[model samples]
Target: MSDVRTPTALPTTTIGPADEPATVGAIGYGAMSIAGTYGAIADADVTAVLDASIEAGANLIDTANVYGDGRSEQLLGRYLAGRRDDVVLASKVGIVNGGGIGKRGIRGDRAYIHEQIDLSLGRLGTDHLDLYYQHRVDPNIPIEETVGALAELVTAGKIRRIGLSEATGDELRRAHAVHPIAAIQSEWSIVSRDIETYVVPTAAELGVTVVAFSPLSRGLFTDSFGPEDVHLGGTRANFPRFQPEHLGANLELAAHFRSLAHRLGTTSEALAIAWVHDRAEQLGARVVSIPGTRSVAHLHANFEALQLELSDETRAEIDGYAARVSGPRASDPNWVSGGREGLI
Candidate 1:
């Protein structure tokens, strides 16, 4: 039987582009999980998650154009028909997923940027996105040119705010100079701390909110699934950290963390997310964590994390254990573009 807990009210946080400010629940929903990335997810299940999120007071709904070929946004659009005003809608572009196999590419050109935003708006069934992000940094184009095009969209009201996903500190600075970068999306968790060295500091210094995706480290931190559950047909099977050789070591570390959580009388998943909240507080930076899950029960569990408060001593212990985690966050170095990786 699945372990289910009582739902708790989640607190709200503010994250917006440059001068614009918008408030959303502390824990946002990452819609990609229901787009069949890991496996087939029924539309009913997707709706349930969305409905549960709204009921739980989670108003930040994030999706991307590449997710299931834009099906993710369409699902949200359908669920958000009358309730659009209740949530902060966010989506991304720049990663082109159409054309023949292998035709996929990242584009930041002015024409491509202009074209994608309209298509995304159509899919999302919204006139203007609360926040729009570049799914990946297009190395071929200059950051200034990309941001310039994005700025045009902001002026035209196609998107209220601009965000960058997987952007390096230098790239973020350049993009911000072109136009105020409202937020930067990157993969950050106890097991994945690569962004802390530079991206976190830079975003903090610039007063840009860091939207930390995959705050549960793609489910490893939750202890709900083990290495044996990762099969060839699954999305996580392609991840290096979930591979046979690395899985054992990673699970061992997770087990240790889970034990610590048990001692604190909370679930591992809650503790893992609370660690992220704690880290953001320590940095004095605005951060929003979007942990994806297709199950309503899991969604409830995730929100419960917002109610947890970790002591300095416990935080240090978790950090020390995380330092010993095995394997790279991403198996493919090419996927680690713009200094962000482990994104789902």
Candidate 2:
């Protein structure tokens, strides 16, 4: 294991659990990467990464039940045993795996919600989760019914706060009316800015924090991968942005941003994370970025974003570069949710 560097002072943001608030670092650790979604990660390496994250002051660790068919939560459960109190543990439900591997189905019915929470708790080795989210809105079940079930969990002390992922503006409002939402997790990055137009404003108005996942744009914003590196097995392979046809254009856009990062004396990954954080600050909405990685070095590089400050002019340049990106954020139509017409 490598030595963990001293992390810079991270800004604080308060997320709501109705009247209650939980203050956590603005940057968090996304656990999906370690679930072997991209590639296999050693158990020891996963433990080391979690240790380094805690050492670097990233106390919010986010994972989902559907990730690796509950493998992610199980891994966190084993690693977080002694240090559980030191972190804000969050896990999501609603998306259930289909009969075939990689096939998935969403379920937000009252019974499914009741059963999944207990299963998540058991797999996580915790009596209560600091924050719980509905991974995807189920089109069959009403949002009110799902939120009502989540509110029951709070009353039962199964989860401290409630969150919704890929929820639309109207769905968010309706859910909030049933129970206050603590956070809204979505794919928001320099390359993917679809959520900013409406989701950000709705969350800001409802006093809900926006938790930005894939802040690195599925590693497209990083220097490690390029157009030639797109493979057929991993998560990125299925993303439209990473398809061979569109990847070259995306890489061209990324190259421009990479040059800007070089001139700014920072890594492109760090700059990408900083851009998301800075944009949220400018919008006057609380945003926490959970950038996931399997490598300790990459994790450290991401944390460096906390120390890099982007000027207004540089931010504009990055924004302009992002506008040039080609292809949809994800290849699967189901992956693109949270819009008015798409909300479940």
By lDDT, who's the top model here? Answer: 2
Cα lDDT tens digits, model 1, 60-85, are: 89999888888898888888887889
Model 2 clash number: 0
Error of 1 at 304 (Å): 1.2
Task: Summing lDDT over every window of 10 consecutive residues in candidate 2, give the lowest-scoring window.
Answer: 1-10
Full-model lDDT for every candidate: 0.82, 0.83
Evaluate model 2: give its lDDT. 0.83
Candidate 1 wrongly placed segments (more than 4 Å) = 1-8, 17-19, 98-104, 337-344
TM-score of candidate 2 versus the correct structure, residues matched by position: 0.93
Pairs that collide, model 1: 17-182
Error (Å) of candidate 2 at residue 31 is 0.4
